[model samples]
Target: MPRKRYAEDLSVEELRLLLIEKQRARRQKRLEHFRRSGRLVVVDDHPTQPPLETLASRPLSEETPPATANPKHTRLDRLLLAIEILAVLGLAFVLLNGFTLIRDLNREVVAMINQPTLTPTPAITAIVLPGGHTPPNSPGGPRPNDAEIPEHLRPVMLSLPELPTPTPSVEQAIRIQIPAIKVDAPVVQGDGWEQLKKGVGQRLGTPNPGQRGNIVLSAHNDIFGEIFRDLDKLKPGDQVILYSNQRAYVYIVQQTQIVEPTRVEVMAPTQEPIVTLISCYPYMVDNQRIVVTARLQE
Candidate 1:
């Protein structure tokens, strides 16, 4: 028997030719099987031509096995795929909205922390009290009764410069009439001693006549026409008519009290339209102050 040739003994050219022959044989076998299964069809114009030879003449790309038919996608499969896509999109949208909300809240908190704080300043402060006077017809004449002022605050009163007197206007209190006390007096701008000498003095910084807040009017009980001599006699509901250049505003007396000279709170501002009348107490011995509070008549 003849011995078979080993692959190791073959030349390079011969090995290459051997691989080509084996590939052709495998392709031919696959093409024949496909033809029998009706996956491949051949038509020849010349009846005498061999089908194998014709197939071998075609390109290698054409000799590939027929592809299997793709599986059909059902409605349920399509629906599931669409649902997966929508769920992904919805999750993305929620994440975006959550991030946006968090960012806005952070901005608001930062703004609140950076905002400025406001402090309220009181409209009235503790200074010298009003309605101080000497004895009626004293030998040296009438003067400020400085003995009543607290010793600690005496320097402040002496050092305090007189505020500029406001110009007379129609909006300011020009006259005051209290029929219950049989008193009618002229009203001036300031409550200083010189201003009080002219007539009843309206305290500076108080509200105007008929307007909101406290309207402080002061006068001496024994001197300067003794404008508020009988202020204590006014009863509740007694009318106190205050006149301006434009018109007159009537206020009803509410109450009266005798307070210490340092009890300056009686001159403080009020929320509603009101008036506070201040005068020295008693007939001639002027020491404590008598305060009469009245509310504007509706």
Candidate 2:
């Protein structure tokens, strides 16, 4: 046998030539076997080698060892992934809170819309027609005309407590001037007993001056300045001037009537703008009512 040559002792050029010759021999042997078996042979440019030996023999730059992850880089990637997950979870929480807030607001608005509205109803001020009074220049001071009230209702009317008068407003009837009757007097808010004692008292539920409803005003014919003493003298076409804070409203007298005290229908609301003046009829005798109806001048 020839002397054995170690791989380490061989020159670089000689080793390269030896590796090429070995590869050529292996390819020729494989080709001969395939030819004998009548099979097609595919040759590889780089022949297979032991995996560990191939990797050890290659230069460090060429090997690339599957690019094992760096410890610092792996930890940084894990941290970034955790931060992204937290960001998604935080966005979801904010969206859920916003949705809950909107749903609550909608419920509150619906509840408010479905709530019932309350309308103010005027209080009942008197039991019977207003302006009832005792005869003028009587022995006792002017008292409620119990004779005018029905016998069965007198006790109830007498027992009724006085109500507080409402504060005067600019829209209410403040004064009245009747040219035919030569009457000029201040107008107050309520037609209750105490209210009529001051001056002319407007019925509680009547409309204000010049409005499209009955404006009922009352005063004692025999007492309380006897403001409506000459109401009967007023004739149709006569002017009844009513004043508010803003301006004066002239109402033309339509008619006058003497009705039983129980005829409260005269004070009922009217479709047109009208004013109703009321007082006890027949001067000193206070059993019936004298109503003067007037329409607002156009």
Tell me, by lDDT, which candidate is best.
Answer: 1
Per-residue CA lDDT of candidate 1, range 103-147, in tens? Answer: 999999999999887544554344646878788677787788777
Taking the tens digit of each residue's C-alpha lDDT, what string does model 2 give over 37-150? 989555775667555445446554563457778999999999999999999999999999999999999999999999999655534445567888778667796787777777
* TM-score, structure 1 vs. true: 0.60
Backbone N/Cα/C clashes per model: 0, 0
Worst 10 residues of 2 by lDDT: 118-127
lDDT of 1: 0.84
Report lDDT per candidate: 0.84, 0.82
Instruction: Estimate TM-scores for all models.
Output: 0.60, 0.54
Once superposed on the true structure, which residue ranges of model 1 sit more than 4 Å away at CA? 1-126, 137-139, 159-161
